[model samples]
Target: MRYIVLFLHLILFSIGNAQQLAGHVYDKNTQKPIEGANVYLDGTTLGTMTNKDGYFAITAKNKMPNALVFSFIGYETITVEDPFSYDKNFKVLMKEDLIGLEEVVIGSPLFSRKKMLAAFKGQFLGTSKSASSCKILNENDIVLHYDPDNHVLSASAENPLRIVNNYLDYDIIFDLSDFGVKYNFNTLEPL
Candidate 1:
């Protein structure tokens, strides 16, 4: 009888100790809830998005040591090292990443814009078999620039790139924070 009582207590204790991170993401300047913000454990596929109310909950269980990443397009990504430190309904304030549109244009007369984009996509998305089936839904949103003198190419996007990976059966909303490819000095080829 005593062993049965101890087993019930252990079960309840374990249930209570389950690690669940719950919080609301908001714009720091506006103090408004940030809907659709990606909340996930860094270096892990476990993730969830903030609801319309900016509320999100992710169960990490034994994975509390991993940093929790809060990401949304146009906002600075936030990483919390100790998510367990915060109580439920924790407020995560994210600041906007100020990127001027005029600055995206680093034009080089040597390489055509179309060619630069193709190069960017090649390096950004590898030439693997799975990549063959991947498609960028919003190619227009991508901004590319090349510097022939330096043999360097850079790319950025104002919005997240919607990618359809038919081979993987996953729709990826990739926020291209920054991308660049530099050519090998001797080969003059993208390295």
Candidate 2:
């Protein structure tokens, strides 16, 4: 009887540990439910979209230290660190991202568009076997800028950058918020 009781307790503990992390996302200003919001554990493929009512639930297998990221188009991304420590169902408020819509005007670039594009591709997509098979579907949507003084190459796109990874057999829609690569000024090599 003692052994059976102990076994049952262990099973119950395991079941409790498998409980999911759930939450609702809403707009800070409008207080309306945000549908189609991206909820994911940062750096992991475990992701899900919010329902029409702004409810989202993702399996929390273990006590993860990763940040829980909430993102959507035209909204400021929110990151909650140590999500496992919070209540099972919490509320997330997302603010509007107004700056993303502002137009950026650039003067004459030091390098040609073609050259800048090549550099951007090489740095963004690495020089690996699998990277060769990957292609950016919406290259035209990206805007590349090189700051000579800072020795940095930056890329921005209003729409999500579409990527087709033939090697991995995956179509990725990446919402690029920020991207910049620093290089050695003298040798023109990535730092």
Candidate 3:
């Protein structure tokens, strides 16, 4: 009799602890559904992506107050706090990041293509073990610029940045929608 009572209590406890968070992601400016946006519980591995209709449903075992983080490339990340406090259905709006620039110009004299490649090589590929074997397959597709006044290095590509990391054994194709690297103008040091 005691075992039966304990089993029932466990089941009821589990049910009470489980929470379902459902929501749709939309663009704040366009009011359009944002598909492929990642939705995840803050500080937990539980995550899912928005479907074609920008709808997502996540089951969280932790009933304690937690935030949900929504992120997508080229858009600002949004966090909803105390998600469990709200009803099951909710909506999230993400704004596009406009401050990111596609290109930059440094001072009056421009850095030659060779100089730009040399400067960016170490910073982009890194000097770590995994970066040693990395290679950029299509160098010509990348356009690089530097702004001396603002001390910023920005890049844009006609196509995605394709790279192969031998040490990590991964091929990464990065979309350069808006990317920038900041540096100190006086010392020409990375910031």
Candidate 4:
């Protein structure tokens, strides 16, 4: 009988220790709930987005109060500590604002315009540079060309370099638009 009582007490204690926190996110100025905002319990996979009404919920895994990070495109990211304090109904207010300055863009839609432009132009940092261009062929191979001094870069892939998975990166530090185009610039060994 005593063991049964102890078991029940342990179960209740664990349940109380692992309290759940849930809430909605909103724009502090708009006075409207934020929808589709990412709400994560700090370093855990326990995350979800606010509903159309800016509502979200998650069970805390530890006794320590978890911080909730609310993020969305355009609006500034907001963080909440001790989310469980407010009766599990957390409210987050974020200020809407622009992110980019000058000619720099922080983020964009997948397969976005910036990505399209950079796909052929490439990314640059200091003295590092890379770029590429390709021509559709009638066969099964891509021919690539790089003429640094002559200013000519090109490639022709017959099969389109098909594979299960592929990874690509670039580093562009100089511009040789006068030379032509590159099919793909990969390595830049400093000479």
Candidate 5:
């Protein structure tokens, strides 16, 4: 009888601790499903993407997450805090950002498109010996901007940036979602 009660308690504990979260993502204006939107728990690798119908499901254990982060290119990022407080089947509406160029402008007097590209190459390609042989094939596709008020430099790509790394003998393609660097206004130093 004691063994039976212990086994029952273990089963009950396991069942109680397991949690499954399910949801759908949609366009706020169109009210249509948004496929391929990234949905994940903030600060954790636990994540999944929306399917063709914009539906997603994820499992968690023990405790509920503090927040869930939803992100996609050309769309605003949405963060849902205390997600477990909401209904099991929830709908998230993501707003589209139509103006990519205006959003990431470089306003510093000392920096131009040419200078921005040079700086980007140095930082992204790295200064290591192997990085010397790396080259960005489609450098023109990258757009750079600097916000004077915030002292921030931001970049985005119209398409995937292609790179030929001869040192590593690898061809790389990158789809940039977000890229930004904060700088000290007075010192012009990266922060």
Candidate 6:
């Protein structure tokens, strides 16, 4: 009978079979949906492409979690799993990789200028501000030899920070500004 056959098919299909997952992929940088992107498991043949609308849906034959690798030209590759990070369909969010930074070194140095250079060097070597054993000069040392070009003793021995001459100037101005008042002062010495 037709009813019997249909019922039998339904019973067999319900025997712990697979389910389809559905969702969309988006580009975080352009704030637009990405279409026609490739989504697939790392070591398996299971995969699909985003629709014209950046939507996707696919069922995993296996009930296990799978690493889905998504890729598109001009964008970073996206890897995703189901809500539980396995063999299930789910939405994915991808971010752009930033490629630039702006850096500016301000002011000069003090204590032979080379000492200030040593301080900056210290920062790179995991030296704490309160470190007592910091070696500025020793068997393996950094010396502050006078640079004729810049008149500052530095590792380069030339072209010292101009702020060195105005060290007290910066301090005087900053200290006065802390009073919630603005008064011009010429030097670090009390006027």
At residue 165, candidate 5 shows an lDDT of 87
* Model 2 poorest ten-residue lDDT run: 182-191
- Residue pairs with clashing backbones, model 3: 106-146
lDDT of 2 by residue, 1-191 (tens): 99999999998898788858898999999989999999999988888999999999999667778899999998999999988888979799999998634456568767777887877778888878888888999999988877888887888887999999989899989997788888777223555
- Lowest lDDT 10-residue stretch of candidate 5: 100-109
Error of 3 at 27 (Å): 1.5
Give TM per candidate. Answer: 0.50, 0.48, 0.56, 0.47, 0.52, 0.41
Tell me the tens digit of each residue's lDDT in model 6 across 81-179: 543344444667666655443233354522434444444344323344434333323213333333334433223211222221132233111111111
- Candidate maximizing TM-score: 3
Ranking by lDDT: 2, 1, 3, 5, 4, 6
Off by over 4 Å in 3: 1-9, 102-140, 144-191
Candidate 1 clash pair list: none
Candidate 5: list runs displaced more than 4 Å.
1-9, 102-157, 160-191
Q: Give the poorly placed runs of model 2, Cα more than 4 Å off.
A: 1-13, 100-191
lDDT of each: 0.83, 0.86, 0.82, 0.57, 0.80, 0.52
Q: By TM-score, is 2 or 4 better?
A: 2
- TM-score: which is higher, 4 or 5? 5
Error at 21, model 2, angstroms: 1.1
Question: Which has the greatest lDDT?
Answer: 2
CA deviation > 4 Å runs, candidate 4: 1-8, 82-87, 101-191
Candidate 5 TM-score to native: 0.52
Worst 10 residues of 1 by lDDT: 182-191
Whole-model lDDT, model 2: 0.86
Candidate 2 positional error at 52, Å: 0.4
Ranked candidates, highest TM-score first: 3, 5, 1, 2, 4, 6
Task: Give the Å shift of residue 40 in candidate 1.
Answer: 1.0
- Residue-level lDDT tens digits of model 1 in 80-150: 88777767567899999997646544444676767777778789898799987889999999987776667
